[model samples]
Target chain A: MLTGQLIAAVTTRGSGASRVIERDLLVTRNNLMVFVSGFVEPVFYLFAIDVGLGRLVGDVTGPDGGPVSYAAFAAPALLAASAMNGAVYESTFGIFFKMRWGKLYDAMLATPLTPTDVALGEIGWSQLRGLAYACAFMTVMVVMGLVASPWAVLAIPAAILMGFAFGAVGMAVATFMRSWVDLDMVNLALLPLFLFSATFYPLDVYPRSLQMLTQLSPLYHGVALIRSLTLGTIGPGLLLHVAFLAAMAVVGGIVASRRLHEQLLP
Target chain B: MVARGLTKRFGELTAVDAIDFDVHTGEVFGFLGPNGAGKTSTMRMIGAVSPLTGGTLQVLDRDPATDGAEIRARLGVVPQENTVDEELSVTDNLYIYGRYFGMPRAQVRRRIPELLEFAQLTDRADDKVTVLSGGMKRRLVIARALINTPSMVLLDEPTTGLDPQARHLVWDRLHELTRQGVTLLLTTHYMDEAEQLCDRLVVMSDATIVAEGSPRELIATYAGREVLEVRFPPGHRYAGWTGLDGIGSRREVLADRVIIYGDDAEQLTSAVTHSGVEVASMLVRRASLEDVFLRLTGRRLIE
Candidate 1:
């Protein structure tokens, strides 16, 4: 029976993970308006700031040798931010509501699924969503003549990695939240990360210590790595960013799964 | 199945005390109790959703502590609270749950329509669960539980919130499952439900089984062959009732009436009236599970 349950857990997680991915990608009738709604918010941000506001800011120096428009400079960062936001949204509020309000996990656990299965499935869905957003955003970047090389393809995987880090960390934090009021703190943490991750400007403008601090931000690594690749500025620094994101994914996954098991099973 | 000295404590509250019992295969067994009687807690342990604080329990000849997942896979459970996912359509709810049991997509596709029909939900298969009424949702939950075709089904207060019609529908489905040789374990506060569905039952109060027998056996042993109820005028008291001591073994004083237990209510009523006990109303009824419950616990069953 134990073996059967474990197998069932694996399959259930796989199906749940797939369902989450499909909910984002598929244009089902019930979700069509919501899908269109998500696009407009980011599109508005892209035009209002990247195009409308960039006219006042002028051109900026790309991390590489080339000079690029401010709009182009900010676009990738917005895309990276969107990736992070999508992942965190799915992992935190969505997961927390399902766990608490919907009692979805409780129902599943009554069957053969375990907390580990749920953690893996939720993270898997977030990563799949992250990759989808990255691909869509990259397509937009390419149409704007901002993507300079095939190297930009790496950003898709980079977005997925960023998703793993954020999703795992977000779910871990969600497990600690006792009510909806605690979600404000989650928003507080996210807003700052969005505004200060050098997503709108180059990090060199800040103090040396501030620059180091920015480098420590997970989004900064995402923005930096994607920024470098889109401009064909590949170097050893790519390896550092990749390693940081990978380590974050591994460590965050471990922490999230452990905490989830403790909370749900114990 | 066996549970020896099973106990569960949540902090300072002992939900289930040291209780011992066993359920044999192929019989309908009931845990009869009132609300807050530790029935749900004991069922949760048996369902393997909650661990036993201290004791030994085995389901299907396997320890639930060590083989919970395995045991759970073969067991069907309908919890007191409806845990159906509201976002999914009724058909999706069953299909997706079957996937949770590792049923092949093809098998689920084949079985989905039949299960929906069996649940009397074929017409609502495409509707989201949020749109369904309470009874429909509860029925959907039962359908979801049956997706894996379990050997044993556990129903905890299955009809607690349903209307009479919906309750009867659920009972019919349960009857079908039992007729197919599925072992059933049910808990309920309804004595009629127990009498109708249970081949055997255990009455629980304060977290322990106080009596166990078939419904009829309990009715005979605990209550008697028959019961006689005599209601006097308002504010009237029993007088000279000691003269009717030879009629039955027990008597109950209720707010509206006085109930006397005896094999012959007609003879008892004649004796009581002849003894100068003025009766405003009189009723004669056979012994029921409710009477057995009242006799054992010294309280009304519905209370």
Candidate 2:
């Protein structure tokens, strides 16, 4: 309920943001294949985990230090990684193209839609898409009997919160990018987060100081939160992860809208 | 719309410099200037899309700084570029833009067919916008701008790159708009376009308005009733006949031709010929807005 109020307050700057989402839906409806491709990468990784990696590794130590199947161990991390990857791509590539080549925002701002509307609408779209990816991945996890807890349902919202953080921050990063050359840096940033956020391994694999440093990665928080829920390791520590992602969302949203306002209005 | 010393600057460059103009209801006003005359900059300000660097601007009787979204809701803008949604079908472009104004879907749906008809893209309503011709695309943009039933519409070079037929089609549609009591503001480098549609206009140059009035008023003030054109052969130096000074109210000499502005072009022509000046060719024509523009800005082309 508090998260709902926070969203309502932040998005109340303009009423036209939903129109941006409506337009994106209109466009995406025609190109459904492109939309589905973003949700498939993590599913492929889940397939690998179930059919090949899980058999090789047998049971691994889960977030709760209990023996959990390798598929369950990696599924939640893949879910979190997918949320981050989907949002980062959607916000960065999608927004950069629309703003630069398409001149879409110029046309939008000519109407009643403010910069705040454009920013929030795009981030919200990414979040919803991330929600869909989360549900599908969770269903696969459940079908494979990886579900050890009913608390795993909370993973969908956690994935969406991850989406909000990564999407808004990715959008902020996109506003500062001038060309594809600058956008190449996004991969340089995300690849490290995906591989090193303890998605395929545990945090203790890194040196003590390195493990501490990895905790600073936003994706690490996402992995920790989703892994704990999917493994049924509920704890008070979960609030810290929720707060971190929420704070990132708010700060990223402000920066993205501010930068876009300057660029569009100036 | 009212503006008082409105200014817009980009870094060290002043795009619009201390210009003032008023747009009354139901009038087809125009801003005429070549490229870099700050016409688009002024239009963007009045459209409430860009903030002023200094000075005050009021659109729809409200300050643009504080009430831009409210002002923009009622102001239609057809930008110089046809910023249409190529991904969507013709009606979807109109529908989505109307939604941007917070209009209900049913209202937007009911309004789409009429707008497409006005833009004359009714037959192509179901097609993707990418398939439309240039003129059709331009019209679609104009139609999309009208989705909210804006009280005032801003068109930046609405027909800058169209062929003669397409230009006339746009002009006809704009004329029909004026008939419906919709106020229109347009910017163009073409004087014929301004003279054709503008109830009144301002000619801007180098980031400032140099002249403002009706076309006839400007021509009579700056150019005289008629002009006599005396063309000289290439590489020939202009021979200023002694009688040239007294033949017309004013005279302007260029590399290829000499122009004399006067009430009677025939009398001016006879006076120039009687002075024993061997002219390659000569013609008499009524003074036009082009003459007024040239007189005010200069004969040199502004890139």
Candidate 3:
């Protein structure tokens, strides 16, 4: 009987996820420009870092501690950051508007869809968008000769994992927001992570204390994981980064779903 | 649907205070109340979205606490606000809402045209929902609620912001749904709306039900068959109210007018005029649900 109830719950959530995706598909179909627009921000950042900033910074130390072009070193980090950005933007601002102003979840909850379904469905959509951005950024990386090894193909899944981790956590944070002003706090948290996660320079440039603090950021794990994959620096320590991100995804997803159930159901 | 001692408390404040009511299948049941009178709260509980704080409530013979998803699966809801998907077209809004209910794409496609026709939105089917008039949007919302052919539909102030023409159009569509054997539960402050649409209703005031019955029954009980209104000039205190007392069954003195309730309005008017009350104007009309609401609550239905 317990298993039967569990299966029933799973099936209901599965249907809810599909329903959310279906609604997003309709929204994207109508506003194709907005769907296409998400691709532009990451590309702009990639160009700004590689062409503008790289001219001044020149070469940096790669994962193997060997000298590599500044663009080559920053490309994978940008890809990781973009995956994070795509997921966070979609899950935070996107879900906030729908939940608060649009009351979209209210309408959905009036149907058979539960709040858990909404969280899962939104996270799924964000990952899908993050995957697309990751693929585009990866292709650009290859064309720029940033791909140092065939193992870089594994970076796509790593990017997806990165997306899921950030997306889940972003959604959990969004459930607590009460007004538009609270959104600035999301930016406040994200900007430092993007700048300090070794995206613009190597972690060795910072003091030991600051470097340790940098390692504590979730984006630091994502950047290190993808950078090692693309730079072909395969080490057993990479498992630690992947495990950290995987744990974040699981815990954050559970928290987001539970918080959504509490807020939307009441 | 049945609710016994149903209560909703938001922190220390009670929104719905131990209300008892029952809604049978295929009837138009109304929750009539002014703003903040717990009508929306009660409707939300019946819709299985808001958890009941205290009481026994059953919808479709299932408990909403444990079976909200199941109860919602068989229910339709039109919220007080326009929760339509503004970014999507009219067709897409209905299509996606249907999908939310787990309807198959083919079935949703088949039903869209029929729903559009019902809502009088066939001509604007491909237009974005943001451009539709207030009335058109409301009609589309009503049509979207029927996408599942639900066993029951809950409308929270279905026509609160709509103009008269739009309101009539929505009422016509709702009436059609009732004729087709759909159970409807709606909340409204408009006494005329309640009298026109509801088979039976409960008047709510200050978080509790003040009265419950058919519109005519409540009007007949709380107010007489007709009301005589007499407005003397401002600041004129008529000492002749005792002479006008026997003309009607009961009399209510307002700041602007004196309302006399009686079985016969014409006789009461002549009697009031004959009493030499020096009235500025006198009018007699049939007693309505508004009178019933006012007499029970000591407050006007709208204000």
Candidate 4:
């Protein structure tokens, strides 16, 4: 019976995702400029890190414990951070506006779509946009010769997993927000994760106790996964990062879907 | 659609008390009441979005509890608030709404122009919805509801805030849908709207149905054929005005006017005039659903 219910849930989620995609297609057709502008933020970060910060930081130790330029070390972490930023922006700000102000999900619920469908569909759209940004960032990395190994191709899927993890948790958090002012809490939580997830420097740069604390942030696992893949640092420890992200995606997705169902259905 | 002992509660507050009603295919059914009369709540239940706190509801022969999505698949809903996408153009709103029902893309494309023309919005098909007037938006919402060619449609206060011209435009489109044999269920506080559009209606007050029948039948049963309204001079107390006692079948002395309800207004007016009660002004008019509602609830419909 549980398996049957699970299958039904999956089917409705597919239906909901398709419905969202249809609406997104209409939005994209009308606002092509806004859709293209999303790629600009990460590119700006890349330029800032390569030109301004590269001169200050010089070469850093790569994931394989070898000397690599600051640009190459920072590039993959920026990709992971951009993935997190994209997913959180879409699932939190975008979903929150639609749920609270636009009342879009209210209309969708009046149809055959369930809250699970809405949650999955929104997360799917976020991942799609995140994937595009990741691909754009990776292309820039390739052009700049920042990608050091063929294993970097695997980072694309890693980026998607990172987006799923952040998107699910962001959506769950959005359900708790009451008004525009409540969004400050989201920024308060996310800015720290983005800044302190070892994105700007190696984990060793932090004190021993702070390094342990950094491991608890979801983005740290994402940053490490991408960094190792780009640096061709094949190690069994990479499995722990994958496992952490996978667990986050599953648990966060379930919590987000349940919370959305409660908020919207009620 | 059928509801048996239907009830909805928000914690300790009962929004809809136990009520029974059925909607037949190809007919316009209305729920008429003042604000907070459970009309929207009941409509939400029938739309298969709001869960029932008590009793049973069936839409399109399926229970809303487990078969909500199945029922919604064949049902259309025009929510009390406008849910039209402000960002999308007129045609895109209809197209995307149709897709929500899983309508094929080709079919939705083919249906857009017909819906636009039906809504009299062909001229504004490419314009964004935010640019449309209030009446245009109401019409577009109604058009979007019909995108799926639903078997039954639920409209919660379809013209609550529209001006007369817009309301009439919406009424005309709704009439067109009923003529095409689409079953429509709507809720409204406007007595004239109920009389103009609904073939049959139920009067709701305090979360319960007070009266139910065809509009004309409700008027005949509760208000009679004609009403005589007489306003005496200010401070002219008519507490002991036995003058109006034997003239009509029923009488209500409000602060502003004394209303006499009967089938023969002329005879009642003649009786009142001969009774020697000084009257500043008197008028007789055909009874309306407003009179029925007032008679049943002892309050004005619009107030």
Candidate 5:
């Protein structure tokens, strides 16, 4: 009987089919259309700056003293931003709404589904969404002649890593949410991370103290790693970026799982 | 199933005081109480969904605190509210819930068709739950509970908010499940529901068991075999009838109705009439679980 129950829980949509079903649900036309629409925002920013600001600023020197357009410089960072936004939307608002208003988690808990199952399943689904956004954005970059080398292949995993980190942290924050009012506080945190983490500018543009502060941000690691790969400027510093993201993923997964256990199981 | 000195405290409120009750296999045990009577709390503890504050509870011969997952696997829970996934179709709800118990797809596929018929949802199997009527949704919940064919089924106020027709449908399904030898435990505010369904019941009031026995046994013990209700004209007080000799016991319900309890309502009504009480209205009826509730709680069960 115990084995029967376990088999049922594992195969139940949460098993494998549900995992695929969940991710498939997130990648529907509306979500894909929204993602494509969001891609236009950053691409428009690139076009506006490269064409509009380019006429004023002229061609800028790459980090390696090569001729580089402003559009090219900001492309990978925007891709990283897209991945972060996707992860945040999925892990925070989507999760919080389901947990609170939708009563989805409540329904799951009534059965044998544990909080651990929810955390794993949600994180897994978020990762899949992250991949879709990363791959789509990367394909666009290639179409726009932004690919610098085979190193860009690494960005796929990097974007997924960024998403994993943000998704886990988002779930952790969602557990502490008391009301819809708290969602604004999440925006307050996410916006600052997006704006000041060197997504559109070089870290060297800031003072040494400010530069060090920006490095502490998870998006900074994501931006540095993806920007280097897309610009064909791989170096030893990329390993540090990978380590930083890996630590975030591990820590975030643990924290989110623990918080979910306390919130749901308690 | 056994609970010894089980208690639950939520913050400063004591929801369930220390109480002991045993549910034997293959019998329907009910917890009958008014709202705030701690029925849900006790059921939650037994279902392995809530932790006990003070005492031991064992379901399927396993302790809930340690064996929650294991015990929960063998139990089916139908909560008071409709917690069925409204987004899913009727058949999908059963299939998914069956999977939650780790049942394989092939087995669930086999069971889903039968469950849909059993719940009488064969025609609506493909319809989303949100579109179903109140009774249909409740039947679907019961059907979901049976997907794994659990050893015990826990229901919390299963028929509340349902119309009489819908309530009877759910009752019929429950009767069928119990007839198949599934141990059933449920809580309800309906006296007739408890009397009709439960083989044994615990009458609870203010977080404690006020009485416990079979429905008829409880009625005989606390309220008697029959009850006589006597009413008089407006402004005519029952002051003269309170300690009347030869009447078994009497209770005034509002200013109009006076209940007289005894073994024989005919004898009691004749004696009251002979005593020249000048009654304006009278009803003699067999003592029901409601009278037993009123006798123990000093109030009507519904109010």
Candidate 6:
């Protein structure tokens, strides 16, 4: 996992982040509704699009330019968005409350854990949640007969990668939040991405300028990568999406660690 | 712990100016000062969590700047805030905190029961921290700090917000830690708490050390042996009373009382009465660290 590499990237004392994950696991054992609830939103979107809208919309052009059912086209993008949400929700609201109210990082820093450990540990937890949502969503995809090819199996890891990118970036954003009132901006930023990042429709539906703008959304790369994998449209062009997500994850991780060290230790 | 010209600055504000001190092993050391006297800042530097702005400092024989995690591994920190995991059980907080120091699972498990007993939270081990009272939460934070079996412990205003009974209980627990030879470094503005807990203390005033020694020594060197308190009626101009001056080594005239500091309170009180000054009541009080701070800084500790 990238978490192992991230740990070595910032510190020699990386076990502290694992300890944070263990604490989160113990806390989550009480209110599993949190995870179930996060997993439900995208499923609802998937069902609404598949059952209600797919009948009216008919087939759409897939990545291979072949005609495919609307459900089939939207399913992979839904999975990618869900992965991003699972991680972002965990990193944003979760980090905000724990840092400001719970004072968990203040306690951890008093021990041997560096800010890098706390950052990666929190991201690692979100990534796990994202993975769970991805797996469950994939299972649903298979049961619904939405999975197109054997390559769809690779979507799970690709979904986790999406989670890491959004989760890291979300954490970096969360560090800048000052109060609960500041949390409204998270919704402001995420709702537009959820609606406009090629999640519900193909990028072709947009005008030329809007389509170009949509590509700038990080979630767009996530959706495109997962969609390519699930559609079995194998090509070297997919490397661009991977590079974007990876770079986002690295930059986000660095900024988050640096910002957190300033706040927690300053 | 050793600090030489340690300093801390926040933008244009200097929280802790150049100050120096040494903490001996196996003793209860205290930073005695009012709010914003640089006590917590110094404590943070010793905790290895806050970076010092200037000067040389060492904790546990290691430089905190370079070896923070390693230095922190051997140290326990009870921050001023109640930093316990409100969502977790009392025992889970301890287990997870011990794991933060990389303690083995089995060892942490074995240590938990004894620690709960030490903290007097054995019955509440499975309870949520939010359900516990503030005193119980304070005890839990203290117990959690001990999970690593640290050689040194840093407590920032440990009993600041506690009620009298809770404060006494916390003091008792600290006494036990000192008896076990854990090097405890604490901060407080309460003279009684410092007198009860600290073997040696430094009086911090305006971001610098005004005095340092044992509690008795600070009282003797700065305060003297006893205080002669002369009380009068409300709105009385007691400061204009004749024969009040030159009766003792020093004199402090408050709104309602005149305090005469001297080695012999009996003679000072007798001299005040013999000078035809009307006194409603008189009492000889033992000198305390509060008086020492007031003498050095000319401000009340709690005010």
i-RMS for every candidate (Å) is 3.6, 0.6, 0.8, 1.0, 3.8, 0.7
Model 5: per-residue Cα lDDT over A161-243, one tens digit each: 88887887777788788888998898888899889998777788899999999989999999989988887887898899999
For model 2, give the TM-score of chain B: 0.96
RMSD of 5: 4.6
Looking at model 5, the pairs that clash are A5-B101, A7-B102, A8-B99, A8-B102, A8-B103, A9-B102, A10-A15, A13-A18
lDDT string, candidate 1, B1-303, tens digits: 898999998888888888888898988999999887789999888988788899899998888888887888898889888888766778777877777666777998898888888899999999988999888988898888888988898999989979999999999988988898999999999998999899988999877788999998998898888788877775565553444455566887766667789887777778777767666777889889988888878788675
Candidate 2 chain B, run of 10 with poorest lDDT:
B235-244
Candidate 5 residues B79-115, lDDT tens each?
A: 7777876556787778777766777779989999899
- lDDT to native, each model: 0.80, 0.88, 0.88, 0.88, 0.80, 0.88
Supply the DockQ value of model 4. 0.70
Q: TM-score for candidate 6, please give it.
A: 0.95
How displaced is residue B54 in candidate 5, in Å?
2.9
Where does candidate 6 stray beyond 4 Å?
A: A1-14, B238-243, B274-281
lDDT of 4 by residue, B35-145 (tens): 999999999989888899989888899999999989998888898888888779999999888888888989999999999999899999999999999889888988888
Chain B alone, TM-score, model 4: 0.96
TM-score of every candidate's chain A: 0.87, 0.94, 0.92, 0.94, 0.86, 0.93
Worst 10 residues of 3 chain B by lDDT: B234-243
The DockQ scores of all candidates, in the order shown, are 0.37, 0.78, 0.79, 0.70, 0.30, 0.84
Instruction: Write down the TM-score of every candidate.
Output: 0.86, 0.93, 0.94, 0.94, 0.86, 0.95
Cα error, candidate 3, residue B275 (Å): 4.3
On DockQ, the candidate that comes out on top is: 6
Residue range B1-303, candidate 6, lDDT tens digits: 899999999999999999999999999999999998999999989888899999999999999999998999999899999999888999999999999999999999999999999999999999999999999999999999999999999999999889999999999999899889899999998999999999999999889999999999999898899998888756555543544878899987666677789999889978887877667888999998888988899888885
* Model 6 lDDT per residue over A176-200, tens place: 9999889889888888998899887
Error of 3 at B103 (Å): 1.2
lDDT of 6 at A259: 83
Candidate 6 CAPRI category: high
DockQ of 5: 0.30
Candidate 4 residue lDDT tens string, A1-266: 53355468777568767788778767978898988778887789889989999989899988777899999998999899888888888888998899988889898888887776676677767777888888888999999899989999999999999998888788888889899999878888889999999998899999999999999999999999999999889789999999999888777777776687778876
| Residue-level lDDT tens digits of model 1 in A1-266 | 53455466567556654543343343233566654554456656777776679889888989885688887788778877887888787778988898888888777877775566666666766665566567777887788777777888887887787887788788878888899999888899899899999988898889999998988899999888888877778999899988988887667666677777767764
